[model samples]
Target: MISSVYIHIPFCEKICAYCDFCKMFYNEKIVDKYLDELENEVNSLYRGELIKTIYIGGGTPSSLNIKQLERLFEITDKFKRNNFCEFTIECNFSNTTEEKLKLFKEKGINRLSFGLETTSNMQLDFLEREENLENTKETIRLAKKLGFDNINVDLMYALPGEEISDLNKDLEFINSLDIEHVSCYSLIIEEHTKLGINNIENIDSDLDYKMYQTICGFMKDNGFNHYEISNYSKEGYESRHNLVYWNNEEYYGFGLGASAYINNRRVSNTRSISHYLKGSYLLEEEILEKDDLVYYEIMLNLRKSSGIDLEKLYLLYKVRLEYNELVNKGLLVLDNNNLYIPEDKWYISNEIIIRLLEGIVYE
Candidate 1:
């Protein structure tokens, strides 16, 4: 049964240069209509399975005013949650306030993820994002003071003109925040973004790799577990909502430009807001065959530090993978029926996953 849900709120106060997600400038009237449509979509599709994790991600969910947020919460309250439901909302420090944080706590939100991409003024300007170091510190302090502990902050690296020292400074600042989780991402200049329009280019590959290594080393030394390729967290603080995806489990994705996996089928919602407001929610669907499911399982499971459960894979898909060669080559590790990529080999995990797929054996 699906126990996780991801809701997309595609309204942002300001667009970032590197963001390519489905987003638009925040509008109160349009947001009202969007929430109405969202409630309709959820009521129509959700089976009331007692959701364990609900992630309200955005184009800045915190950008909404207090009344709008209240409406959003009323809509989400329709979902059935257990005693330990983990409700998370993505916030921007520029917009998040003490009042909103209080509302979130009262409404069952247990986690807050802020987009503090960098502490460098130049880097922030290049990204076309605004962040005040003092504000960030204050907001985090307030969240913690308000009894919210499961907090996450993002760190972006590999920007043009960014050096090792800059990256280290950013890492040091984030590590000092006392947050529970950190998600480090390398900047990729997508074709349709502001950066791409200006003919911006990615940093040198070697430099990018070096920056990633620095982040990993810093996070590790700071007592965070590198649970996933780009995510680090305190022990037991891993994102349970995201793990639903990496485990290849079914989930419901609601709102504009969201995707869902359910009943062996993949579903994507329309990115066009006009089309969405006109009551056309679905854009595409892909029905997965046994082979497709197995391929997905292999690809997604290998992303975790715990890796793939070889025996469980066999029991579920009847597909026996031959990875002795990879193990001998030191590309994969086999232990207790779990096959995983070593942390050291995670940098080339995609290539390793491709090679493993090439050697798949059907039982």
Candidate 2:
């Protein structure tokens, strides 16, 4: 059964140089038309399934004006989401205003995620982004003032020319906040981004690894649980919306270039705004075989610190792989009947997951 929905907003005031997500500069003339079609897409695809979470992610959800946001919320209301546990909306600092945030709260959005890539103005300028640091701080303060306690801050490390000292500065700043959750990621230069076009080099591998480990240590020391590969939260503050993705659950996605998985089939909308606005986005469905599903589940679930539910694996695949020995060897740790890599091994999770998947495939 589908339990989550992802709504993508593909318009941004300006495209950040490091951003590779499908996005276009905002045009007032096209927004209304685009939103009309987006509502159509959502209404047509919703199956009246109970939604546990709804995540509005994207180019920048806060870029929409109050009227546009209201229209979008009206579309979401068509879904049967009475039991929704969390409704998250991703916002960029430059565009998120107190009034805009108030609209989200009125629409029942309980969780807010701010993409504060770094607290350093130097790094912001280096990336050609004009986001104001004070604005970000004020926005978070406003969210808290407006009675939002479930908040997530996004941090990025290992950017080109980043050093350990730079990362520690960010860590120190974040630790001073009342944030309930954080998602820190290493900077990856994807093709088509300006960073990729400029041939920007990555930080040294050893230094990058050290930075990652330092972040994990700092977050744990601050009493946050490293729940997922890139996420840490205070107790009971884990991202319910994101867990749906890691669990390989089906969801609906509405917007240009958005992807959805439903009934074992994964579908993607056309990346073109003109194409999506004209109702030509239903031509991107792909089905997965049993092996594809197995590979996907293993790769995604291993991203969680609690690892996979071994009992669920046996029920779904009817095959069991012994993990007690891996636990004994100290590479894997068992807790609550699940296996996870030790905290020290989080940076090498890809290697650990690959070995487990290889064994599962051979068996």
Candidate 3:
């Protein structure tokens, strides 16, 4: 039952220095053409599956004007998600308005994800995100007023030259909001981003790790579940939409630069906006061998707090092992039928996950 969907919005008001996502600075004429192409692309992708979760992620979905946004939503009309458990739309502080929030609500969007990034004006400016703090506060207020209770606020930690005091300030501000979900990510200076070119050379690894630990402690103390590596939620507010990805389940990813895994094949769409608009859709496709599937499944599942399900692994891969080896090695532990990497090892989960997979493959 493929019940999840992800839509990519490739337009942005202004590209942030740290962003490496597919995005282009706001251009009115170009966006109009993109919207038209987006509709066609979506129509071609939906194969009458009743989606249970729909996510509109982006460079910034809120970057669209009312007309362009409407065209995008119109394409979504083909989807029959009457059983949809969650429909989330990602927005930014600068573009989210009461009217926009209402439009989302009307279109069955129940969750609003705000790219709050950080609470500090200094950090916001440093990222070239000149959105007014008051505006962000109001955006959340409007979302809540429109009956949106499933709100997720995104924050970042360990930016260039950040301090413990800065992280504390961010935590303090987040706790004050009526947010039920938080996705806090450590700053990764990816190669193509402006931050990578100009500022990444000066990052302090120890300080960054410390900030990550602080965020985990603060969010846990404030009644949030460290559900996934970079996501925390209050009980039932965890992102059902994203779990599809971490579980390695198949779903459709439409729009430029999006990737999808379906029917045991992984496919990626063309990244060039012009090429996409000109009808060059998918760029690559790779069919997963049994071993490849196992590797991918293990890699994604380890990111969750519940870790991997041993029974599910055995059921899918016909694999088994003596659990004692990993537990004795202090890499994994079994609790209530689920396997988990202890929180302490979370910082080095990649090494541990690879080791666990090696054990699975060998046994």
Find the candidate with the highest lDDT and give its number.
1
- lDDT (Cα) of model 1: 0.93
lDDT of 1 by residue, 1-363 (tens): 999999999999889999999999999999999999999999899987989999999889999999999999998898899879989999999989999999999999999999998898878888998566679999999999999999999998999999999999999899888999999889999988999999999999999999989998999999999999989999999999999999999999999999999999999999999999988999999999998999999999999999999889999988888788999999999999999999889989999999999888887
Write one digit per residue (lDDT tens) for candidate 2, span 1-363.
898999888888878888888888888778889889988888788888888899998888888888999988998888777744699999988988889988988999999998888877889887776477888678888889998989998999998888888899898887777799999999888878899898887788999899988998999999999999889999999999899889888888888889999989999889988788889886578899877788778778888888887778777876565666667778788777576787788788888777777667323
lDDT for model 2: 0.85
- Model 3 lDDT tens row, 42-112: 77777888888888898888989998888878877778878455888899888787888889989888988
**Winning model by TM-score:** 1
lDDT of each: 0.93, 0.85, 0.84
Clashing pairs for predicted structure model 1, backbone only: none
**Candidate ranking (lDDT, best to worst):** 1, 2, 3
The candidates, ranked best first by TM-score, are 1, 3, 2
Cα-based lDDT at residue 103, candidate 2: 90
TM-score of 1: 0.99
Better of 1 and 3 by TM-score: 1
Clashing residue pairs in candidate 2 (N, C-alpha, C atoms within 3 angstroms): none
Q: Deviation in angstroms for 249 in model 2?
A: 1.4
> Better model by TM-score, 2 or 3?
3
